[model samples]
Target: MSARIGVVTFPGSLDDRDAARAVRLAGGEPVALWHADDDLGGVDAVVLPGGFSYGDYLRCGAIARFSPVMTEVVDAARGGMPVLGICNGFQILCEAHLLPGALIRNDHQRFVCRDQQLRVVNDATAWTTDLTAGQVITIPLKNGEGGFVADEETLDRLEGEGQVVFRYEGLNPNGSLRDIAGVTNERGNVVGLMPHPEHAVEPGFGPDRAGAPRSGTDGLGLFTSAVRSLVSA
Candidate 1:
């Protein structure tokens, strides 16, 4: 049987459909979950797609953190439900205390959109099981407040515990502290990142494949990784 993955659609969410499509393309069932609904509907996994939830008012993901669905998501994640948060979703995860640290305004104080190169620093997470540690991949990254900020002690803990899952390979677009682009919970079931993997799942639709060798569709591995982990789990 195929794994059922839930994608939450909060107000002003722009990538919900794309995330759902990626899940379907990866041979998993995509279940649309509303922000108002508390039930996850028995989804095997969950994805919080990137977007300006609640119009990004009063800080990105701040208001959305109180959504009814988030209560369920938080509980499920703590119970090892395998939650993946992308961009704005990552912000929500932090605000909800599911993930450590917080996302602040970009260093440049401007919105950035580009094909970002990242390294899989930790492959132990459920959402990154298909990748090998140190494997490099390119994916779509667009955001305004992508800077990850935490104290030195927290940073040390994250690094020591191997919670830093993805690191910026080349340019740190948002000037995130320690070049950290993604992180996972201690159990590796909940992950939050600033990049958008759903946008790069398709061959032609993703980043160009001609210029670089074996780089296009780098985002497909993320979805496939989650599906594979869910099945095996």
Candidate 2:
């Protein structure tokens, strides 16, 4: 059976449909989950897509963290359910304490939108199993407060534990510490990244590579990896 992947839609979410489409393209069934509902609809995995939830009020993802649906997502994630957060959703994961560190304003103090190159630093995570360590992939990244910051100790711990999943390959758009673009929980079940993988899952819509045509569909691996993880489990 196709894996059922839940894509949560908050009031201000902009990429919920894109995430669902990505899941469907990856050969999984997409289940639309609502922020007001406390149920996950028995999905095998969940994706918190990129968007300015709650208008990014107070702080990025600060208000959305307490939404009723997040309670269930937290519980399910703790039970080893695969959770992937992208861009604004990454902020939500950090706010929910599912992931460590916080996203701050870009060091350049400007909203950045570009085709970012990222290296797969750790392939053990549920969302990155199909990638090999050191492999570079291009994906769309668009955010204002996308810089990742944490205490020195926390950064060390993440590095020491091999939890840093993806790192910026070329120019760091947000000035994230250590050029970190993504990280995963210790169990490797939960992953969060500042890039929008859902937007890079399709051919014409994805980023363009240097020596190739606009064939950058590397983001498809993320969703397919989740399906593989669920099937293997």
Best by lDDT: 2
> 81-190, model 1: which lDDT tens digit per residue?
98999999999999999999999999999999999989999988888888899998889999999999999999999999999999999899998999999998899999
The residue ranges of model 1 lying beyond 4 angstroms of the native Cα positions read 211-215
What local distance difference test score does each model get? 0.93, 0.94
TM-score of candidate 2 versus the correct structure, residues matched by position:
0.97
Write candidate 2's Cα lDDT for 1-233 as tens digits.
Answer: 88999999998999999999999998999999999988888899999999999999999999999999999999999999999999989999999999999999999999999999999999988999888999999999999999999999999999999999999997999999999999999999999999988888877778877675538788999999999878777
If scored against the real structure, what TM-score would every candidate get? 0.97, 0.97
Residue 17, candidate 1: C-alpha displacement in angstroms? 0.4
Once superposed on the true structure, which residue ranges of model 2 sit more than 4 Å away at CA? Answer: 210-214
The TM-score measured for candidate 1 stands at 0.97
